[model samples]
Every structure is written in structure tokens, then in C-alpha cells.
Target: MTDVPRAVDRLDDLVSLDTGEIDRTIFSDQEIFDLEMKNIFGRAWLFLCHDTQIPKRGDFFEAPMGSDNVLVVRQRDGSIRAFLNTCSHRGNAVCRAEEGNVRNFMCTYHGWTFGLDGELVGVPGKSIFYKDKLDLSKHPLRKVAQLDTYRGFVFATFDETAPPLEDYLGATGRLGLDMIAERGDMEAVPGVQKFTVHTNWKFTVDNVFDYYHPQITHMSAFSVGLIPAPPDDFVEGGAKSDTGANLEVPFLPTDLHNFVVVGEYGHAISGPDQESLEVTAGTEPFAWRHKPEVEARLGRHGGRVAGHPHIFPSTWVTTNAQLSLRVPRSPDVTEIWWFSFRDRNSSADEQAASLDSQIHFFGPAGMLEQEDGENWAQSTLQTKGLKSREIPQLLKMGLGTSEVVKEDGLAFMDAPINEHAQLWTYHAWREWLRNPSWEELRERTIPRDRY
Candidate 1:
């Protein structure tokens, strides 16, 4: 087996956009994972909790930022603040609960209490043990460098120099959120469904843009009528013909067009075009995108992006009115968190139906996720093998064939089912691991005339 090159010396060899091949070591290497935590997760703006999750003052939700856990708390004045969950004194988590309305966080370890704004307010033995030498104000929980929200979705970054939330999101990212926000007065559902997947987080992320897998990986879904089967003509044209002796599964039709939007900082939206989807489904599933106001906001191209939009590192915006965070725990372990949303004004029955769909689609209990988890787990496992890790993973479908059209602040393409977005993501990933300046990173990731 070939030995892997040092990360710093061979960043370009890790992922080659020109050849659409990625090194497998990136998925399982401990040193590379550590670098990612510092260069990507540490510096990038990470999604925390939705603003609606902690609406009331003193409400707090524990969220993971890289390896550290943080408490996203609502201030007394209705502002939001987030700080490390660890107590300043003893490094013990001050708040134990995942979420709740807390008066103040008092460390059970040493009785060091902190205010909602992350101010160190009380120390139990300050006067006796320290003889009043310890200052409460000197040791507040370490706060995040920057925190902001976009359309009620909260994000924070440890890098103080990271761009503002809007600037970071850019047009493609904003359009992804807008797809959900413009649906109505949307708010997060009460509970966030979270589960562990024994896979590298990158697999879960790139899978968002994979249109090729559903037809094969989700054949069981089609067999059960969970997803609409392709038209008879499409099946005849592409499916393997089996007499009564064998199982016949139709493939994703080749003629169907996919809309791919790739943006700065690894953000991308890739899947079937809304028009192509209507052609297959024989009904309009995305009528909301056609609404005058929503169309005006989404623009011509954005309105047709009936696909998964992924922000750099880990946020995934789904068309089913949900956001998923693929949190990287280690090289081989990832935590998937699903935050389902609903319009505040929707009817009870509509809300119930939405919740049911959300529950049955991609969370812990969801069949699709269960199927996907197994594949990702096995894929991650193979990356650890001596021979397998030496192999380059191929992503060559529709690679050099697509022309990128720049319009309305989006660099996109309408092509057949392809890996353009996936390739684009890896390209961006390589640049990010380089830890360039924000301007330099943007320059490196800027979409070219052809993807």
C-alpha cells in the first residue's frame, strides 16, 4: 500500500478537481481530522440553534462546536449569547441539561455560577478559600468570538475575523435558507432529533448533493411506494429487464435535468430541477416556490433549485422544511441533528402532517437515514484499510462536460445527474484546509467558467 503524504505538503493531492478523484485518507486520518477541526470547523461559521429554540429569556440549549460543547443562552434583555459549557474554574460542564430555562448556571463541581450572558457571577468559597483574592469578573466562561443569525437560524464562529453571517452565507447560502424562510412564518419544531452515525462527517455532507444514489440505495423505498416510481417509459429505457425470475429496479432516468448551484466556501445546492421533478411526479410539489413573493425573492434560478443546499462544513437545508447539522465528533464518528420547522400559522392538521413527514424522512426513526447510515458507516470503515486507503475515490460523472453559467450572483448549471456539486465541495474543502485569509479563500473558491 502507498503511504499517505503529509497533509501540509500535499493538500493539492488530497482532492483533485481536475481528475475528480479524492484521497481516501481524508476520511479516516487522525492528523487530517485534527487539522479539519482547527482549519475548517474552528474557523468556519457553524450553525448553533435556531432563534426560536430559545425564545424566552434565560432559555438555553447546549450545542456542539467542534469538540467543545456550548450553551446558547437567551439574555435577560432578549439578546442571544453563547459560551463554552465548561465552567471557568474547574473545566466541568456548568449546565448539564441539553436544554431548559435556567435562572443561572452554577457548576456542580465547584459552585461557580455564571449569568445568562456568560458573566461569572458567583463563587461559593471566594471569601473563605481564596480570602477574597479571586475575582469573579476575571473568569467568565469563554464566549464565542462572533455570533449572528440569518432568517432566525443562528450561527457562530470561533474566528473573530470571520465575515458577518450574511456575507459568509452569500447568495447561494441565503437562497438555501430563503427556500425555507419564505414558506411563511417558519419556526423550529420543539425537539431536535439527533443520533450518532459511525461515519466520517464528510460522507454525510457530500451525500446531500448525490442524486445518483437514491435510485439504487433507496430501491426499497420505491418497492414500498414511499417514493414515486419513475414513468413506465423511463423504466423501459433504463431499467434492467427481468422476467418473473429476478428483481427489477428502475434506474434514475438519464434525461432528467439536475440544477447545481455552487458558491464560495463550499456551499452548494444540487438535485433535480423543479420542472424535471414535476415531469416525473406529474404534479407540482413545490408550489410554494412559485408564489409571487417567494419567486421574486428566490429569483428565476433559485426558484427551480428543488434540491439540497449545503453550507460549508456541515449545515444542510432540505426542501422538506428542515435543517440538518452533520456534526463531526471524530474521524470515524459523526452526530446528525435534525431541526424540523413549521409555519407558525399552519393548521394543526397541516402541522401534524409535516411532523409526520419529517419524522419518517431523515431522523433517527427515518427509514432513509437508516439506509444511508449503513452505507456511510461501511464506507468510513473501508477508508481505514491499508489497501483501500491507498485507492482514490472517483467522482467523474458530468465533471468536465458542464458549463457554469453565472447569473444573479449564482454560478450554476442545468445538467443531467452529476457529481459537479460533490467535486466542487471537495475543491472548496481543500482550499479551506489550507487556512487562507478570508479574501484569499474566497478567491480560491470562486466559481470558474466551467466547474
Candidate 2:
């Protein structure tokens, strides 16, 4: 393990909240990544396998917890548990497969066997070879500190002191999950779409709130009609700073009516205001949310905000009925996992239609991510260069220009397509990297005048 910096007080030097300029080294620094794995990843409640993924007893799913992998298993009592995959005798993995139903896990290296509940059950030639000196009870795989489910979604954390799953989710995080949970009996698609994108995980995370990039980064998406753009001289957010061009695209309208919600403890939601979108595009993108019950559950903020919602760390809920986890392999490598969802209550045809839209937009074969991956890869490369890294990355858009409006136990600001969410995430990222107490983290991440 790399030596972590003790002087977290100096975090402001790396992440400038005042100037909205972040030092580029935070993206690719080995030391910084080490700190992140220890503080951010270790403490935050990370998304694990969905409850639907391991429905049957003895079924399991291998999930990433930072650089470590854990086996999420369903026990005989119809409960879920997660444990480290490594064997106690040797560090070799007991299960080599990514996921499946198994009665027991026998390590290939030494044939030490573990039960479905991750208890050490057998060791080959224990009596003959070691006279049963080793205590099998002591050798059971190490379990996570906490495991819980909300709306059939499983999440675990290594911090015993961490808040309960629901409290940790806060208003922002719940709404993110509600985007799918409210869809009337949802389940994870049979197989997760897993792929690698050569970018720092932070890029993928902050990009979720980045509504500005779509029209430009994914212009091809609009050109090819992957994203339905409105017709003619529609303008949004006044003007694009780079080209000084208004939203004058021939195909799509410019008014996304973007909304943003920043929550305590680093959770945030940002994207096109779906209601405004339905009006401008002459289509109802989020018709499902109109139900009175769903609206009551979503509250005012959730009901009106239609866009991508990102929980702290790396869980992203996109508008196209998908939940994505950007698992960090290292500073420069991230594994993207997509869990497509459908309203199980809907007819087969409706589910199929949802799946078709979901697959084409952002999955492994999705046209949009292919473009995003290229941009994120190159953007990461620029940060690795010695001289190039000295230049600060700017998150100045709408920086200090908007006031946070408080409502329904949440804080947010409505702006004309700005980087407030991205900058807010980084601000919270720095606070998390400082390894503050959970209370302090929640306090630090509260919405402010500027990100």
C-alpha cells in the first residue's frame, strides 16, 4: 500500500473550490488513487449486485469493492451476504467464475472449500496433512462490514460506522434509484453488459451530470437520430462558450431546461428537465413518472427532475432505464458495467421496446459510449503528461453565478446547462479524500453558493 498523506488540511491546494480550477494530477496520481481506495471507496456505500441477480439460494455474483472483489451470495434463509473471495490459507480466489449457482466454493490452489454462506467447510487432507490444527471456523472468508438492500438493489460498505443504507442515500440518492424502482416491478436484465473504458473513473462519474457535453461530444448521436433532437432553431442556456454559438442545430431544439439537485454526502442529480423536454420535443420521455403515487414518492424535486442521477462515488442512473457502475480498476482504467432494467409489470412488447432503446443508447454496443470512451481516453492521456498536468482543469461554468434553492429537505439550483454538478462533485470528492467523519462529510457536501 502506498503511504497516504496525513495532511488532508491541504486538500484545497489540489482541488480549488474557490477558483473552480482543479489540479490535473488528482486524476492519475498513484498516491491520490491510494487515498481514494482507502477513504472514499472504503467508507462510501457502494453498489453491489442487484437482488434479482442472485435470486436463488446458492446463487452468487462477483462485485468490485474498490480494487478488491467480493462474492455476493444468497443463503438458504433467503438473505444476501457478501464476502471477500480470497481463501484464508492462501490469498488465491476460491471462486474463479464471475457468477453462477454453486453449492460450495473450492479453491483450485489448495482445495479449501467454503459453503454458500462463505463459511470454511472442508480442507483437503486436513487430518492427515495438518492433524486438524487449523481452525476452519477462523478461516471463513471475511465478510463486508455492512450489507443491505433498498428497492431490491444491494449495497455494501466496509465502514461499520457508516449510516444505514436509506439514510446514506438521502433525498438525492433515493430519487436516483426511484427512477427505476418507480417503474413498476423492475429487474436486472439477465446479463450485465461489462466493458472497459480507458479513463479515470472520476471522468465517467462527473460526466454523468454533464449535460453540456451531449450536443457536442455526442453530436454524432443527434446526427444519426440516436438522441431525438427537436427540429429547427431551438436555443439553450443562451450560448455555448467554446464556439459562441446558440442552440441553432437544424435537427434538435436547444431548450433542455436542465435541472440540478445536489444532496448531502456527495450525491447529486443533473440532466435535462424531463418535463420541459416532453413539451419541447413533443414527446413524453418520462410518462411513467406522472402517476400520482410516483410523484408523491419523488417529492417535488424528484417528480420534476428528469435527467441522469449519480450517487456518491460511481453509481449512475441514466434516463434510458439503465443503472451503470463505473468501477475503478486503477487511476487510468475503469470497468463500466451496465444493468438494463424493465418494468416487469409491462407487457412483453413494452419491455422489449425499453430494452431496445436502452441497448442502443449506452451499453457495450451503444453508439454513444463509443464516442464518450474515445473522449475520456484522450482526456485522461492529457492529464498524464508531465507538462500538461501543470495546467489546471477548469470547472468554472455557472461557478458562483447561481444560488442554491432549498426545498423538501434538499438543496439545488436551476441553471442554463452548467457544470455546477461536476464541480460540486469534485468539491465533495476533495472532502471525501480528506477522510472526514461521516457527519463532517455530509456537512462538507451540502450545497453552497458555488461548487
lDDT per prediction?
Answer: 0.89, 0.85
**Segments in model 1 whose C-alpha atoms lie over 4 Å from true places:** 1-4, 235-247, 282-284
User: Measured by TM-score, how close is model 1 to the native structure?
Assistant: 0.96
Instruction: Write model 2 residue lDDT over 258-290, tens digit each, in one string.
Output: 788988888989877776667644456677788
> Which lDDT value does model 2 have at 445?
79
**What shift in Å separates residue 354 of candidate 1 from its native position after superposition?**
0.8
* Best model number under TM-score: 1
Over 269-356, each residue of candidate 1 has an lDDT whose tens digit, in order, gives 9999888888766555576677798888888888888889999989999878999999999999999999999999989998999899
Colliding residue pairs in candidate 1? none
